[model samples]
Target: MSRTKKDDKPAGWRKAEIIEAAAQCFMERGYHATTVDDVATRLNATKGRIYHHYATKTDLFFDVHRTGMDRLFSAIRPVHDRGGPARERLVAMLLAHARAMLEHHTYETVVAQGVQVHRFDQTTEGQRQTMRDLIATRDTLEQLFKSTLEDAIAEGTLAARDVSIAVKVLLGGLQWSIFWYRPQPGETEADRVALAEKMVAPLVAGLRAAD
Candidate 1:
């Protein structure tokens, strides 16, 4: 049966529900092992609703990946835009990034893993285009980090060095924290923010140009 827009609920709501359900499945079973039916069942919906929004499992998976990455980048986009001293903005960006990751740990995990296995080459032309767009969005987010780092370097708030390498080290350190941070009985977001600040402080200090 052909699925049409009329068959689905509001486009925004349907897409959000499917992405949420798919993220849950992808996180639990990994992307390669997850199926469209898995997401449908998780949401207590049917394949028709899934098809109305996504042409294939690959397409839906791409949506899940994109949504997760967007959430992380959106968390810091405002901080990046709010004009301020590079050092203060950098600190805010790092803390925001860290909080987003810790709060959406499962989604972040799936996104990190999806980057390795979700190849656009495996899909049809249309699907490949969608994947390319998502990849572009991811790259755009990374550029924000790069720009902030460069600004800090130019302002002498960060030490003189390769900005690209510095951005990588910063992201790698922040992302890897997801694997080690466990919420104890009293651990809070503030605790995570403190840890993130501690991690960034030394890197920022070390990067500052000698007076």
Candidate 2:
């Protein structure tokens, strides 16, 4: 069945649908190589269907990148905001991040590439603004981790001379999973949960202060 209609009325699901298709195409073929036709082919729809929502391929790509950042926020922001020791909250946040890496694999994959802004030319004002906003979002997420790390250091749970480097090391480990993690065919959420826990323990312990 057609998820979109011929009428001009907006279906709220249409935009998200297009973004998902675009993410998959970008993930498989890369942003430079993927075309509107490629995304349409993935959706089993026509180019007009995608064009209805997004005027250009760059707009759709940025939307996919934005949606990926949104997913990361949804997964980790609540855990970061809640009351707890900073170490515990950091652990929870890292676990949540790892799970997001596996669960929203394609979107996260696109987002990782989107971080390399120098590769793409943002010629128009709108595209430049979108890149600025996306960079701000990335900084916000990193700051969340930096704040948590600072708390842990102040509390003497974790010791680090440079919080900035620490943040990069921690997040870099989790982010690298999108490259090497090949999910088993029959794996469940439970499996990913276990892997996330296993992956985070050593990372957390490495930063622990001497007794």
Best-performing candidate as measured by TM-score: 2
Q: TM-score for model 2?
A: 0.91
TM-score of each: 0.82, 0.91
List CA RMSD, all candidates. 4.8, 2.7
lDDT of 1: 0.79
In model 2, where do residues sit more than 4 Å from their true spots? Answer: 1-10, 207-211
Reference-based lDDT, residue 122, model 1: 71
Q: What is the number of residue pairs that collide in model 2?
A: 0
Off by over 4 Å in 1: 1-9, 119-121, 181-211
Q: Can you write out model 1's per-residue Cα lDDT over 1-211, one digit (the tens) per residue?
A: 2356544557788788788889889888887888898999998888998998888887787778888888988898999999799878887898888788877777887787666665433768787677678788878888898898888889997777787777878777888865776556787878777776776666556655761
Clashing pairs in 2: none
lDDT of each: 0.79, 0.87
